[model samples]
Target chain A: MEQILANGVYLGAQYAMIALGLTLIFALMNVLNFAHGQMYVLGGFVTYTFYGQLGFPFVAGLVMSCVTLFILGALIERFLFAPVIRRSSRDESTMLLAAGLAFFFDAVILLLFGEKQRGVPKIVNGVFNWDFRLIMPYDRILICVLAILSIVSFILFMQYSKTGRALRALAQDRTAAQLMGVNVDRYSMIGFALGAMLAGLVGGLLVTITGVNLGMGGPTSIKAFMMVMIGGAGVISGAIAGGIILGFLEAIGLAVLSQYGDITYLMIFVSLMIFLAIRPQGLMGKPWG
Target chain B: MKRRVVLKSAVAAVALSAFAAGGAWAENPVLKIGFVGVTSGPAAAWGISNQRSMETRAAWINETGGYTIGDTTYDIEIVSFDDQKDPKRAIAGMEKMAQEGIHYVVGPNVDDGAAAVRPVAEANGIMYFPYAFPKELYTAPASNAVLGMVANYQSGPAIYKYLMENKGVKTVAFIAANESDPLSQRDGGVAAAKELGLEVVSDNVTYQVDTTDFTPVLTPVLRTRPDLLVLSGVSPANAPQLIRSARELGYQGLISTETAQDAQVLQEGAGDLANGFISVGGASTPELASDAMREFVKRYTDMFGEYNDESNTKVYALEYILETLKANPAAIDDVNAFQATMDGFEAPNPYMVGDAKLRYVGSTSFGQKRQVAVPLVVNVYQDGAFETLFVAEVD
Candidate 1:
């Protein structure tokens, strides 16, 4: 039980970080950024090249990932999404654009990174075996701590900062924010860039543990989407809650359902469907607070 | 005027002959071979090795005066498709090959892709060598899908028997990814372990292919404490993670897999933790690799920036296809003729140190000559490379 809890906490921390970024983008733009996972993968590759290949400090690599993704997000919003959202009548237009970007990123990742699975040297070594009850690697524990710290920082920023306040105002009511003299166009781009930065931060932190691959992009996006849906489509707290819940479910299901084998994932999916059927709006879909 | 007319007539005759010669040169035939497999995505290494091997060999053949089959010399051209590991896409890849008029091809590397292309291959008179091990694929009803490399069923028993006799392996556990190819391999490995009188401690554990954390997945399997742990049909991407997880969980037993693996992937993913892992690999062991094999590796490394050791086994599929075609040229456009030729086809294995013969043999498992008889070279991972352990063969 202790081991399962530890495992769940670790998984939940990282998963929540991933969900936070996706939900943030959706909240700001109503775009449901399908390319969020690819952004995460690109962030991982950036770190891999910087730290693993070029022998830079790991922290430097992570900061580079965040900066690179932030700029990319800003440009994409400024040049692509912003114009499309203005010209189009339906939100599905944004969805189509997001989907197209996902494919475009997939091709770019393949062309640039090739198809080989890549991994970095362990940041920390040795296992923390607690009386044979809880066996977690030191590296995993460090990553979990880092992930939690990032999430906490994000929450604090969203609560206190002026930019965060403006972004929140925009997310709350775009027309009202525009009427109140907020630069709607600029904050929308910043919001998207900030969301992308968070994805990169988490991607950098987790790359040491799970490694990165081109194929991981689509599945990562799918998993992130599930977390958003569980939390409530455009709710930040809901996304975090959804991520943690899904993480624990996986840890527990894998631990308990060892006897039943392949049906573990099947059971998890079935439960998700049941929950969705019961509460169509999800756990935190009602409001931002 | 008479002198001018004669000179013009002679010049016209020379120009017409030059044109005729140029037309003859342009008419030289190109024999097209096809490869349909996953060349991108996580499992890309598997199919990439297969495609690169075919391309490398084709280029070698074409550069050195081309290949001759039944007195007609033809340049070999490899046409490839990236099925992206999808069954429907693999079917489409095969149809594309048929449309291109390629009669012989290599790959569709995994079981699902291999099985999916069988009907298309048969209908189009295309003979394909797939690196999959479904007995039904090689049985009487299916004849076009030749087993490209040693199957898990064949390699599993060979590996288990060797471990039992040499390392005193008395008990075993099996874990597999929850997919068709891996599940099939796990079942086969379990049966082989049981047949060898080894106690099967645990065999039903499976994890999703996309699983990032394998600790919880390995915890229960490690608790069983078997002497040997077989990772069934593991891909290059997952192998190192599984090894690292098992080791971290304090599994002290021998770890082995029937699938060929990339040494670089293992080294990068698990580092020193992967040291002692055993797998079936290409015949690239220093003791077994001949000068021809060394040159091929050099060429491969030159062509691609790095080399995947799995190509050791993959290089033979194209060789077998070409060799069989050479033995009976009538088989080039008639896959039925190719089937008829398989029973008696034999040639000297060019890449091995011994007087080994290249042939088709699967009578023991499929009651037909439906598998390439490459020397099954088992490899043990140490440091950053795979060293040859023992070599075996399947009938």
Candidate 2:
């Protein structure tokens, strides 16, 4: 049971990080941002190149991954998303554009890095012997701590800061916030960059544990999207709740099912169906106002 | 004017005929070797190694003025198509090679890819050399196909024998991919373990091919506290990850696998954790290899920047193939004659193990002799390097 919970916490922290990014994007821009996962992968590769390949300091690589991906996200918003979002078929064009960007990013990484699986050296190697039956790895502890800190910091910012409040107001009521002199365009860019930076940071951190592969972005996107939908598509708190729920469920399923651990997907889908049937707006999502 | 025109015409006709004759006489007979395998996806390492090794081998042969048979010398060339580890893509790649009149073919390293391309190669009467270990590939519709390495059945017993004897392994926790090749591997291990008086603590653990996190499966296996963990016929792509996960979870038991050939990749994945892991094939150290194999390994690594899995086997097989070509030059045009030459051929072993001869396992069910019985050695990664231990002949 402790082992199962350990796995759940490890997996859930990653899910929460990814889902938070997705929710932040949706909250700010009302775009699904399909390319979000690709940004995550790009960040991983960047860290792999810097720390794993170039032999830089691990913390430097981590910082560079966030800064580089944040800048990239802002540039993408400025040049690609902004132009596409203004067109008559804004939603359709933006979705198509994001998908295209995802493919482009995957192809670029494939060309640059080749198809081999790359591993980043763990920041903290080996387990810390607790003398108990349960063994705890330092990496897992670091992951949980970092995830909680990021979440709390973001929440605190949204509650207190002028920019964060404006972004929250925009998420709640775009027209009213605009009438009250909130710059929607600038907030959208900032929100996308923040979301992308979070994804990048998680990717860099998780690559040490999961390893990085060219095809990882697709799976990461699918899981994060699943979490977002389960948590209520645009709900911040819902994403966290949804991620933890899915993570624990998957861990428990794998523990019990053993070889047939693939059945976790079916379980998750069934739970999603039941949840939708019971409450259409997700666990914490507001109904269409 | 008529006399001059006739003189020019006669000169042009003679030049044309002479040019035609020269073209025919100077046309060097070429031996085309085709490799169809996964070169573009997650399992790209396997196919890439195949390509790089074969290319190096061919380049070495070509540099020596090619293989001579009768009064003809043929330039050796390798043409490869990437299948991406997909069955349909493998078949398409095989078909493409066949269309290009390539008679000699090698690889689709995975079982399904081999299964997909085997029929196409056989139908086209191509000389197929497969590294995959599925029994179905060696069974029906096998025309000029030869198993280049030890099959699952052959390696399993050898692997377990080494563990039970050399490593003093008493109990094993077995995990294999739930597929035909691996299932066969599991059977071999079980039979060998039983015969050798070894215990299987948990014999029924299997994982899907795409499973990345092995903690869930290893959690239960580690509880049994077996002396050895057997990951037979698992993809090379997954073996390192699984081994690393087991280590991360504090399972200190010895990990052994038959399908892991590339120690470099495993080391990269597991870092210091890869120590004490056992795998089949590969020279334990540079000193264990023959002079020829040492040179080949040096050249291969210097060129590609990585050590290939079973470098000795690849070089030996290529040399054997070259010798077979020398014995039957006409085999190029007639694949049956080529098959017969390979079937009847014998040579001294060119690997680290002495007294082991290059031979074949003639299957009565397959109705023809295919599959070369190369020397099977058990290797362990100790102190961040591979150390070769026991050497056994493939029966």
Candidate 3:
């Protein structure tokens, strides 16, 4: 039972880190950036290039990955999403466009990186002894710390920063916020960029824990999407709640039922379905669509 | 009337010259050989190495004035394609090669890729010289044209029996990737255990392809308290994880895997946990101190700069194929007849594990050899490196 909890907590931190960016983007833009997962994978590859190939420091690689993706997000918003939003397409079309972009980026990644699973050098290599019997990797503890710091920093930004206020306003009512002299377009671009940066941060963290490959992004994106739906899409607190709950469920369920059969993925889906059917507004009373 | 005569004469002249060129080209009769494997993706290293080895052998054959059949010497050309480890791509690659008029082909190095190419090779009457473990391709609803140069999965059972009888391992457990192409072959080890009257305590299957976390699977097996654990997988990455996780969960027993990749990398990853692990493969370690083996290793390392896990086996096998062709060139014109000659030919190839002699079984479906006595070496991780425990011939 302790082992399951330890595994769950480790996995949960990674999941929350990944979903944090998605939640930020949806909260501000009311646009689900389906290409988020591809961006995460791109960040991982960039880290690999910086750290593995160029022999840069691990921390520098993480920062470089975040900054690079931030710029990419800004460019994408200006060139792609900006025009689409201006044209006023149906929501379905918008969703399809985002999904198409996700696939396009995935293929591009495959072409660029090939399909090799690249391992990252460990940043902190030692097991943490937790009183008597429990032991875990110190690196996993670092991940949890990073997640908490990120969530706190995000909360602080929203509460105090002027730009953050403008983002919140836009999320609440884009038209009213535009009337109130907020630069909606610029803020939306910034929001997307921030979201992408967060995702990149998560990607770097992930490589330290799990090796990165081309196929990792899709399943990760689905998990993040599930987190978003369960936590309430636009609610930041809900994202954290959803991530932790899902992580715990996965850990506990795998511990109990793994011997019987491979029911880990099935259990996750069943939980999501039950949650959606029972509470249409999600955990936070925030409607997803 | 004069102009019309001129035009008719010109047309006749063109037709006559075209026919003459066609006849000249037709008299040459070019035979094409196709090579297919995962030339890209994570597992591409294996495929690329196999292709290079095949090319090297082909170049050597062609350099020696080509393969002579009867009174004629026809040059051998290898037509190669990248399967990328996808089944659909494997089929497409086979069809494309077939369409390009290749009658003989080599590879589909791994099992899944071989499975994909098998039906296509059979349909086109193309001889597929697969690099997968022997039994995988030959044991099924057999195709005479498909030949495998590697040792069979039954090799595992042979190794296990030797270990149990000699090394005193009494209890065994089988753990394999659920989706691995050779997952069924784990049964070979299981059956061998049963035959030897060694306790077969558990059979556990983990998810295939990308298994990052093996803890959930290993925990149960450790609880069962088997004296020895056998892992069936290709890479060191998976093997180390299983070994490390097993150790973390407080299980101390002998651990063994099939490939040298696991033996080397698992030690690096798991440190002491990888100690005492033994595995079997087609190639002997370079440290064996045999003159022929030493020379082979030296040439390989000199050419490629490092000893690749399976490259020696593949490269030498290709050389064996060329040597066979040289000895019996007449067999080239008629594949079936050539196969017969290969069956009858018996010269020990030092490239195989045990200075093993190769002979073709009369059964065409079974390829060139029904069995080759590749020597299996038992290695233990000692003082941070793999040390040979025992070397024995596994027939």
CAPRI classification of candidate 2: acceptable
lDDT of each: 0.88, 0.75, 0.68
Residue pairs with backbone overlap in model 1: A231-A238
Interface RMSD of each: 1.1, 2.8, 4.0
Better of 1 and 3 by lDDT: 1
- Model 1 per-residue lDDT at A224: 92
Better of 2 and 3 by TM-score: 2
Determine which window of 10 residues in candidate 3 chain B has minimal summed lDDT.
Answer: B364-373
For every prediction, compared with the true complex, DockQ reads: 0.57, 0.28, 0.19
Top candidate on DockQ is 1
By DockQ, the better pick of 2 and 3 is: 2
- Label model 3 with its docking quality class: incorrect
Q: Give the TM-score (vs. native) of candidate 2.
A: 0.82
For residue B297, what is the lDDT in candidate 3?
A: 51
Q: What share of the true interface contacts does each candidate keep?
A: 0.69, 0.31, 0.05
Better of 1 and 2 by lDDT: 1
> How far in Å is the alpha carbon of B321 misplaced in model 2?
5.4
Candidate 3 per-residue C-alpha lDDT over B1-395 given as tens digits, one digit per residue, 9 for 90 to 100: 99999999999999999999878545444446677887653365566567766665555556566666556665666778988777788889999987986656777876777777878877876667665654646653555334444343544665577677777878988777654444655666677678879898887544444545565566666667888888865454466666666765667777876654433344334556667767554356655435655655555555455444455445554454545555677545345554556656776665544546654442433433433334455566654566666666533
What TM-score does each model's chain B reach against the true chain B? 0.92, 0.84, 0.76
Task: Please report, as a residue range, the 10-residue window in candidate 3 chain A with the lowest summed lDDT.
Answer: A113-122
The second chain of candidate 2 has a TM-score of 0.84
